[model samples]
Target: MEQTLQTSKMVTEKASPLSRRVTWYIFGVMFSINLLNYLDRYIFSSIANTVAKELHFGLDGIGFIASAFLIVYTVFTLPLGFLADNLSKKRMIAFCTILWSISTVFSALANNFLSLFCTRMLLGIGEAGYYPAGTALLSQHFPSSQWGKVLSWWNVGTTVGLMTGFILGGMIVSTFPHGWRLAFLFSSIPGLLLGFLVWKFPTKDTETQKVSLNRQLLKQASIETIKRIHQLLHIRSFVMLTAMQVFAFFFLGVTVTFMPTYLQQKDAFHLDAGTAGLYAGLMVVVAGVAGTVLGGILADSWQKRFAGAHILICGAGFLLGALFFAIAMLSSSFLLFSIFLFLTLFCVNLYNGPAAAATQQIVSPAMRSSALALSLVLAHFFGDAFAPSIIGIVTKYIDPTHGQHFILNSAGQDLRLSLLAFCPIALFIAGSLGIWGTRFAAVDQENVALPAN
Candidate 1:
């Protein structure tokens, strides 16, 4: 079995058509675009506190607003994924980028909660198209052996964009009047240009197999779609990996929504928004980048010795990450919190690359986008989509009067308590799921059916 597997890998490598330079160029463009995706998506989260003050909404309101975007984001992903599978991926990506950038620009025009919520929901619609298309497009470019590394490299865009949103939002909001508006305005430009690049991406290579829209293809039945989804769910490893995604997304949603505010509160760091953002953003870049890159390398390298290495790495990261996350949230001292936060971000981010690679590996080339889209639908909807609101409710109602005398508001302390409650427990559950999934990975891989390359 081992010899046959080795031979198959060797053949796939030789069959790959992407030259190193072309491959890297595609990666660079996709990575940059992906960075922009998260940058615009999280800018709202980065400046949630300011928005709440200006709009006269409480933290709970902020939670609902964040959830609004995610609900829209989750709802549209599968439809967009179907389009991604049937249409030219670059074109879909290009259009999605432009759509989201325009939505970000509109975000700058909002003065009230309703307007902001509407703009964010639109942003969700625009941003939803990129992942399914980009992931599938890139997966088709590399052999299976390279998916973990390349996807990890691409996934770093999330950490970079998220960090940039916080840092940029921080620097601008502190230095100037109406900085949040400017932040949104500034973020929209790069995507417009990147969308152009995606649209014009060289199609000379046959390997860049552009799935074009045809009459019959357009009329493809819903039953076929259902069948595709059914196949993916039946794969035990895939099911577990997706089940784990929900918890991880929930942890991220809560953190992104409230961490800056948490750090800025008097009882905590007592820093200005800029300083708080700087600290949060720095942690994201430093620790997040480290986790993602190293995780990818470890998964790829370890796979040589272990068939379940990708899932194993994900499980270990999530478990270790949860421990650090709990410590970071519990620490009273700045030094201790910072140290544990770095550790938490590193371990929490470790699953990005390996998880992406694993999902792709188990599905066929044709269903890759839709399968991942299905996972996103469930993960984001149940995970981050309601996290802010759930946390918000907890903060507002659950022992709402506990810390009234402290420098923090009732909600602020509630936010801390909420994070303490949700983040670590979710991470632990996610880790446990990943460990359980590892056992099925090898069996699933051996059984996966793929069309001839």
Candidate 2:
């Protein structure tokens, strides 16, 4: 009987998707995966200064190293995204989780910039594989009416992961010698364990052999994919949303990558690394969590009355976020900076739920994963992928500043100038695009409900 059950569970069936109990279970697994995904990816931010010191990398090298992961991440998103719609999402997520976890282990062993950069690239592959698949799976499980709330919960996982990554990275680094490496090793364990759980999750009877699933993919998948891509692009709302993601991620990359170090600047907060990490983590996570959850609830409520509520909320959030972020940047008072920083984080995070839900809603159920994957490919590539490096280059050219410990010419000035020049303007663009997206949302989403040709 045990053998029979094991064999039965390994086959895919075209029945009701899942029971309520199993649905929640799968949600738990995907949520956990999303959380760990961000944590592992951004822990590097917390330890970047320390690693740069040892590796003799300046701001440019630091930014370049950060971009390495994004480049590979961008490269892999579409292929895995294509597979997610055709293959077993659970298994693919499992494979990605395990692969990235092992890669992170190797990151601990890296002794040079090149070795570490290579490991980060591997990490990117895992993360890129998980996101679209996870989002697609959840989309199928929930009603469109509930998509905002559901994805908001998913976004919470991402926020928490980022928080844990920074806080843990700081605490561990402060507590132990070579703590940065240990942080990598420690974080990898949870992902390794979670990967196995996702692989075996929900039921034994619904699993499909990867090889068999491959045979079921579109016959002329390349041509089919292109057609689908073109179809999605024809939707004016999708185009506007994609444009929003580009600017949003770019400025987000600049701030997330450099803010911790910014806290350590002599002319700024002058906090130690551990303190800096804690403050950054707490501020971002708390505000991010509140914004994501509230934004979803509010958007969903507003959507009933307005066709473009998602984009409307996102536009408002970005505008408010820009204001607070700008205040944080220009203020000399630590108190005012901290307060505005919190507001900035909250406002910016408001986009998470509405934006994610919008993508899922405006496309056919069949194209959910592919649409998101393609969007991410473009978003990260043009946005965060090069943001760090570009900002680093800008910072590198600035004149030096004298400081006590860990001073590197004018590195602080470089980071400050780079952030100020780009962040507000980027948010302004994203906000404008999002607001314009509202005009087309009702029409585009209506098309998704039409009968298939």
Candidate 3:
């Protein structure tokens, strides 16, 4: 009888080789899609100088364009999250990919600042659905035990995409006439094809989990959505985690939007767009990859011995990242600046996987997408949406006044000072919140029903 039970357990525990291969294939496709998502979003930053000059945009105008995307992205995510929870996530992802890709193509045709701004807003609508749907889909496939590791690898797509965007945009703008437009046009192609691939691919979990709908059921689902949101907010750990993300993402917004320009204008560097892009991309990818992977592994391993190991790891990363970033901003030597910047990125990224997985662990399966969407809305709206503009405003105001107008300086000092003032403050807040969150992590996880493998 004991042998029979042991044999049954072994058979149930082991996944078939073919099943494992298919699982990895799904991960690969999703990773590629995520890469494209960020690449399209960040390419503008890579060629900000050219775009600003050609479009006759001042510093404030440039920041406004970036904020427009985040504003729209944040607003649309809630409804998309609702759809993801109730409908087929795979189909939603496919549709969003196609929509964003088309918008990206249209950006190439934009003739003026207004046209380009409109295109970016449309692009935000298309891309807002991807994260909530993608993360929910991942939750369906992997068990709680492996969530950190799986998500860490998935998050790597972000760094890779950012790197590609910076490098590709820089290369095109530097090498070709009307290169910024061409860059946008070229970036749209892969996403178009990838959208079809996502639609064609068989996602077994999505198929199996389809919910039947009627008027009564629709009403119930809507009610449940509201109740779940209230419940999620009530969870102390979840709220704390969200708070931590808010501050962390604020720094992220400032860095990604302005770092390339900063590096170019710095007295010690004075690098062109191409060189700045190459170096920034390389630094982000190398440090980001290492931090993401190591953070996940350490979080997972440490969780065995500590109740809130993931939160602890995240807190340390934020604190250390801020310290390094401060040093980088203060340094006069280019090499010293580069080294510290790499460390800053590495530490900042350490929370990506663990924080995401923690949210999933605390929420019920039905509310997973909504929770993530809400998190995104809060993080972007309060954190990143205004950061670029704030920095830009600070830069403009600090510049010497010429006649009646405050002239914008290209010396990089104003921008650097703005970043130094904001980034460290935000990072410190995030780290403190992360540490506070550790106290409630175990209790929150216990309240939720663990999803089956």
Candidate 4:
């Protein structure tokens, strides 16, 4: 039976073609799953203040909880990445979705910080396998000719899920008396349901040959995995890009984490916890959608003419996003701030699709999951995971007089302003990395075309 399943996946991989409609369907389904994954994470951000207050968590404590998710995410990512290389991508994804959903549902039942932290950590473990497996599945399902475009659209799910989570989670929490717990519960349902769909979905032909799961991963990860990651790390361009991305994401995490509180404190926008969450969620949705669509289109067009076009475009987008955000911070008008926020999100998202495609093209198929996993490992550990928590601590420093008193109101702006410094620096570094990627584009092309393990 296992051998038959393996044979089925190989046939699917070889037969995957560049059909337009099928490509779109693949994008839609994958995007939906991606969205759900993020929605699960963002629920906490939308209610950071409420949770912190209720749990009596200080800045450091809150940061630790946020980072706890990543600690587990990082731990599981590489193992799962290797698993994707050896196992059925479809089954792996289905299992992961269910695991995470169960964990998320339990989040609402936690009574203390430790329990909540452990639940989130478990949630991270389930989520860890998602990206590498998802990416490998997409690559196998689509022809190489269409990878750039399909991956971009697939990447769009991140924005969509985040936006939905923010908007839905925020509104629910705001409107209902017990909205916070409800928010976590509501998000879990869709994910749990999606696991069934994922199972039903056809497996890629290349994925038919499932490897023995009993095989230990750390020992099995190829020399190529080590060499490729080493090469990626050593590349001056990638290093700069990673550094920039870390900072950019750090700023994003901090902002989103405290956005509701920022508005309440800075703009005097009095909202129920849910309303504030909805507003912040909307910000991510609008910005994420616009940025992804436009960025994907631009990256696809540029890739045809220039080897490093995607990276260049990514750099430019980040720079534009940073400028808009910086300008928005300077202005006090709510209307102006909204426009800038939208613009900033748009620019920031431009990198998502292109980065994923580029990463795939740069590494070997056998090593693809690990390469991507390593990236996520680095990004989560260094970027989004601790960003919100860091900003929370920073806010405390900015107004030590208030200590924890100002966490809910009037003090978040100081943190926002201080965080402004992170964006431009990140953009500059990302742009420099794009330039570096151009030099090795040919080398990557040579390595990527090698046959799968």
Candidate 5:
């Protein structure tokens, strides 16, 4: 009976396009939710000045508040990722939505840094399960032929979410005298509503081998799960891919965390938080979306000719992203700076779709969730977990005499310079890792057994 169930699952995975479309629809809905995830996380930085003033916190305190979420997000992602493999993806997303949504609203109500930190941590617990579950659900639902395109569409949510949060938050703060809190509060509504939409949608069962309902199924062992994760890690491709993820995320974390402040300080822009967010969001929408779609299309097409095409593309993107970011940071003209930032975002997203698809392709269907989770763990651990805090520390050390006015416009110049150097360094490492990843794709493919469907 157990063997029959496993075979049935395999057949279903192979033969069902009709059912797969339903998964895509859900992917679209969930993708929108993902956008909100980032919006809530990112808008804080855009309005850092106002938040710090209102809360009476220094740069270190602000960094701690921001880092709190990433720390929780990083710590919980591994366990939640494991749960995603074993549990219902739909339920996981729904419950997490509620958790983060509530925390987001509570963030608006916080009286002190500690209160805000606690709320962010709770939000992290909710968000922690999202990526692994979302990735696994999409992979299971989509066919191999369409995985790159489908994942690319899903990836659009990140840009959209960041843009929406920035623009919307910025608008609210500028229009209203005391609007930053309202902006955070407003961002939570869409997610809470989306949670309802997800619950109403029919959920597909996880494509796992069947276990005896009459026996202790919950306690059953999963040799395949352990073996697959072990094999994926040992694969040189996976290792290098993970290194690439780490580098990409590190750059992403630092840039996102600091960009708004840099703009205000370096450009001498006096725009309210919402206006700054609007500009940044527009850049992401224009550049980030284009890069993601193009990358997916290129990877899908290029892979037919070159076995390591995806990694090579990623390598090129990272190198370009690094170069563009350095130009953006150093440019004296703000318009030219914006152009560079736009190009940098474009370059970064160019590699995202291909990298994700390549990672899954090199793992078996049954183990793809765990494999991706492991990749995420390594990425977040070495990348974002310490990023915001590190930037804050760097700022303090670079210009310690800036004193309590760390939130002032002048202090950000040194911060931007430090980040300019650090971000490029991380991107360069990621670019090199991408090249290293390409070399081992053939060997990795041998162990994971690509999908026949």
Candidate 6:
């Protein structure tokens, strides 16, 4: 036993420096890609009004376009995630980046609704492989103790990308003759370059043995994949966590898709698209940065004293976010609404890091990608996949007689009412699930053979 201990200590000491360097390197590259990923994804929403007017699409049509991207994205996540588990994640990421970038460029060339929808579908296919592969790679590099901080920092890429997308997209549309198309064209360039960079980076493959693409191996892999998914479903904590993600993402999807348009069209605000976009972008960046950093730090600190601390933090964030957002919707004063909006964004974002870290902690390393894949499938499909369309449908129902000549102010009222009815309910349910899931986190973590911190 003494000899074994001595050998283990020696091995750990030798691995530490190399591991730390590799961890940071991977984080840097993945972080950049994540940022680009969201920037490309959200460009359409930032310029939603311009696109809708140019293409002659109704509110429902606009929502459908967003939904199409998410639907394809959700559908492809599972199969692509399976590929990440069995293949070279670095190569997969590179290929995905290139494909998506090309699709973005194609979006710029699209002249009508069908063409644009097809390009968005292609964009979804390209982006589908990124999150599972990236998150799985990050989980492999860091131990559980550091997961919250690392994942939180990684998620900063998302908020930053969102801010850039909104501000940049707005600027392009306001400044250029064909700004929306130009925005897509310009965004594609960086993604193409990033793909090359990711390809050149010396990322280590997590899979121990490279399986050949033979019929026999493919058959076995499929069988194993099914069994693995089945096993994931049995984990009570994971199920609850996924359930929470569904509701949380639903709220997010609806807000991100329409909030700028809401500000621009509403009677109370009635700001132009560019100004609305800039304000909304600033709100997300300022509030998101502060909240994400605080959430990770607070969860990590609380974890030292209690089990399932991350879950508790997430629960609080959801409940508080719900309350603030509801107040923001109701308030007539612009200043009060902005204050509440900032608070709402901050509270909603608090879950970004902790939830991701908790997912990694509760699962074994081999199953991490699959676990995330399943969560994404459920959260996105049941949550955000239809949220925008549902909101649009609700708006149409509330003002059915508007027809082809819908008044902007009336449209805004319909949207606000729909959002007010749904967002709070989903958030409340998410919070309740988080609280309930805390009871299972300790046992779930114990079941996994986690690496030593």
lDDT by candidate, in order shown: 0.83, 0.82, 0.83, 0.71, 0.77, 0.83
Model 3 lDDT, residue 151, Cα:
92
Relative to the true structure, candidate 2 has a C-alpha RMSD (angstroms) of 7.2
- Mark the regions of model 4 whose C-alpha exceeds 4 Å error after superposition: 1-26, 204-209, 215-218, 222-228, 231-244, 266-271, 446-453
In terms of lDDT, the poorest run of 10 residues in model 3 is 7-16
For model 6, state the Cα shift of residue 181 in Å: 0.4
Across 1-453, the per-residue lDDT of candidate 3 in tens digits comes to 343233222222122234677778888999999999999999999888778778877566668888889899999998788778878888889999999999999999988889989999999999999999999887777766788898999999998999999999988998998899999998999998889988876664442246766887679767876886788799888889888988998999989988887777734367788888898889989999999999999998877666578888898899999899999999988889988999999999999899888788777777789899988888889989888888878867765641112123254777778889999989999999999899887766656633355
**What residue pairs clash in candidate 6, if any at all?**
none
TM-scores across all candidates? 0.93, 0.92, 0.92, 0.88, 0.90, 0.93
lDDT of 6 by residue, 218-304 (tens): 897789888988989988889998999899999999899988778877554887768877988899999998899889999877766
Q: What's the CA error at residue 173 for candidate 2, in Å?
A: 1.3
lDDT comparing candidate 2 with the true structure = 0.82
State model 1's lDDT.
0.83
lDDT of 4 by residue, 1-453 (tens): 343233222322242665767656666677888989998977787766566667777555666777788778878897787767777787889899999999989998887889989999999999999998898888876765556677777777777777677677667766776677888898898887788888777435363346564435446556545766786676544554555566566666666666665665643455666667667777777778777777777876766656566666677777787788888776677788788878888887888877777676666566667667877778777877776666666667777574544654556556566567565555555555555556655444544454556
Q: Cα deviation of 90 in candidate 6 (Å)?
A: 0.9
- Tens-place lDDT digits, model 2, residues 29-60: 88888888889988988888787887777667
Worst 10 residues of 4 by lDDT: 4-13
Return the lDDT, model 2, position 131: 86
Badly placed stretches (over 4 Å) of model 5 are 1-24, 209-229, 266-268, 450-453
- Candidate 1 lDDT tens digits, 207-276: 3345455766556735667877888889898899889999989998889888887877666677777887
| TM-score-superior candidate, 1 or 5 | 1
Candidate 3, residue 377: Cα displacement in angstroms equals: 1.1
